[model samples]
Target: MNEKRMLDDQHFEQMIEEESICTTDNKVYEAPLDALYDTAMHYCPGCGHGVVHRILAEVIEEMGIIKDIIGVAPVGCSVLAYNYLNIDMSEAAHGRASAAATGIKRVLPEKYVFSYQGDGDLAAIGTGETIHTCNRGENILILFINNGIYGMTGGQMAPTTLPGMKSTTSPFGRDVETMGAPLKITDLVAQLPGTAYVTRQSVHKPGNVRKTKKAIQKALEYQKNGDGGTCFVEVVSNCPSNWKMTPVQSNKWMEENMLPFYPLGDLKKPNGKEK
Candidate 1:
């Protein structure tokens, strides 16, 4: 069984590296390979949460460890991830997903544990837990969805909110003087020795989506191979509904505004993990 699992993982790695999906000449579409149940997502139009979820599910399925995964969700737009992701899931109080995930990992150390969180829940209220968990070198994956504004709480300014960006709470442009600059928490966490990998990415385009998947897949493989540290994947996404722009406009705004501040790239990579 172990040898078969190893072979399966190798097959997946090769398939992922090919960078293209092959199919028949006829265009017969099917639901995503990892859609465990027939349920629709509740995300607003152009929201990146659903795509991120699907990517995680795909990686989990490819790794052949679907049953061995445990997902922790925080109180934000993706609070109901358990519904869409047909896996063992638990919900944490607002900004407490990291804490809950810590306990879950400690108890069920054998399972592939991860926490799905939003910028508001992770960078602001749960800053302490986020720091401590990474500081302690917890062996888990942190999937942080950083969409500058608080999408779940009616477009409030999040800790990651870019300067000159407006939200319900900040009608005028964000005053960096008063609010402080947008927090690059990913960089801050990378400074800690306990963190093994830190990469900021986006799923706004097809090529970016593929890179994001590779980032996640690499992070998971690193974790599985006794890299005793935290793997943080910060996804800089867009909030179209809160921004009051169409999906296309919102994406363009992100490229113009958000990318300038939260540039997408790997901030840190541990020794021997860079490939």
Candidate 2:
């Protein structure tokens, strides 16, 4: 009995010493959930949607604009964004996120407004609405997620799909001649006089992810300050399931194929600087 007590005392002392070494100030990272709900995300493994969403929520929280923000998510993989973000999020018809955001922002000019859309919704169906919104120089943020293919609605070829890329509709490959060349919508928008900031980024690498987060933050800040007509941020992401490759393989393929077509960097900036 005495021997057991001595061992227990030694163990207790060791635990106490360890706890003393690990102080609250020593903590490096903690998941941000002030603006996000504590629930499992519906995105596939290695999907960049979750990462973008996290950084967006973090930015909103850090800026102290949770209640002063309104988001529009149209029909796509991100249609259910309201289920995760604990903020005022509204649903829009297919490819009408920008229009809806315009209405909302016009009605409530004091609030921070943004639209979250996917490539299929933005580049194809919502192209007209998107172009007009930017042309009007609406004080809103347009978040475009480009995965090269149509996700959530059968891996079909999207407007942003690269040449020679295979999809459900284009089994042979995306032929630029027959299917029309891949749309450089970001570059196209940058040419418009109303766009204040236009940048293309990716989330497959840690460095790129950090840069994307920073870009998103700058976009919102620009909107708040009325620095430009419109803020457009395109996050070139990967679709592992739709691409029919593992998460690792899809990222590698994106790095090699997608990056070349839709290179990362600022296409336009509010200060007249561009790449």
Candidate 3:
């Protein structure tokens, strides 16, 4: 596995070099493959994972820490993240991404570590690991993608699913009376003394995309400084296929519904501020 990883790295690096474009002004622009592999992604049409992956790769490249970063991905839509990200990656059992990331960071204190998880994996089955990891101040970043429903598992309801949100498991829409209100895991963790940064963001708009990237960049920087106990970023995204809406419709629905419940902005900041 190690040998294969090295070979893959070398191959992708070579591809980047070969694809470099030089302008007449003597400036060279390299292809966006420094931290992301060149292969096509497996996410569904209009999925947010592809956009998020690109920004992550850009950040790793900008920070020049491609070799020093490790990512942990658990079961769900992002389970194949290792295949997309060029950096070293580990696959954990469902909802165990935080635990796996904690171990990796502990073993390699010098390296930057993060976990990429979806709503179901992070807010549902993995809730225990996620909360405990944050409370323990694990010194790692947790990238939470909350689409409100299980995108890869037949559109089942998730812990983050909002009231009146329809899913395969909640055909009549989520009922707070019996199903309980949607979990604002980001807000829940922000109150923990162990968490140094907590924010909710999205990528449905160009401006929001920039904010999300900045949030991720800041989270990683906090980890680099080794001051923040835990940095949690929640990206409220859309699930077009599972929601039975066109890519355009999902984004519209998300704006009208998801954004109102899981508002975008920082819930906690390292500078001792909350919004």
Candidate 4:
């Protein structure tokens, strides 16, 4: 017991020493660490998940809703969103994130609830739940991450896969004639009467990161103010590993290829204008 206590004390002292050294710098622009736990992330090095998570944390902290927000996560690349975000979270079945988020928001109307889902989860399997949730105006936020390919599973083609985009299942490039045109889920949800603020934004760079953070803030604001609608924020991200390219190359490819098919901006809103 004596030896164990001494060792524990030594480890604790070492941790404090390391923290003191790291925190000594008076660096400007250091983001607040209130809403994200200090831990290793499982996402790829250049995965936009980290940036998106940081923006969410910034918004939650700025709005003073860190304790009043709940997140619902579905399967796919973001299955572990709850692990990084310091908030009350509930796991949902694959493609059922929207339904689960609706239930949680309904039960606790005062709390801000949001769902973090990937393209495959939202645009394919969860299509019905997503449509219904938006149609009913569940007063929740849907953070849709569309990377065109299934990242969690093998790099399979998704409903949002662009024309001529190659994936594991689409080695010959997506044949739009038979595979069907990409489903613009963001626009589809915006046409629903229950949607309040619907916008497509990216966070590949600092400028876009700021814009995305504001978009998130606005969506939460609408829900908090009893807007009686759904807020859908689509984040066009890249899948470096699945896309078979370096992180930098993948981002560049996304800018050239993905942006043309799915142009960014407000697709739809309650007032027919971005707020």
- Please state every model's RMSD to the true fold in angstroms: 10.7, 5.8, 8.8, 7.2
Q: Pick by TM-score: which candidate is best? A: 2
- In model 2, state the lDDT of residue 30: 56
Q: What is the TM-score of each candidate against the true structure?
A: 0.87, 0.91, 0.89, 0.89
TM-score of 3: 0.89
Per-residue alpha-carbon lDDT of model 2 for 94-118, expressed as tens digits? 9999999999999999899999999
Where does candidate 2 stray beyond 4 Å? 1-23
List, residue by residue over 1-275, the lDDT tens digit for candidate 4: 89776787779888878766545365556555889888888999899998998889889988999889999988999999989999899989999999999999889999999999999999999999999999998999999999999998979999999999999999999999989989999989888888989999998878888888888999999888875599999999999999999989998999999988888887765555644
Q: Give the alpha carbon lDDT tens digit for every residue of 73-169 in model 1.
A: 9998999999888889999999989889999989988888889999989999999999999998888899999999899889999999888889988
Worst 10 residues of 1 by lDDT: 22-31
lDDT value, candidate 4, whole model: 0.90
Error of 4 at 103 (Å): 0.6
Task: Tell me the whole-model lDDT of each prediction, alpha carbons only.
Answer: 0.87, 0.92, 0.92, 0.90
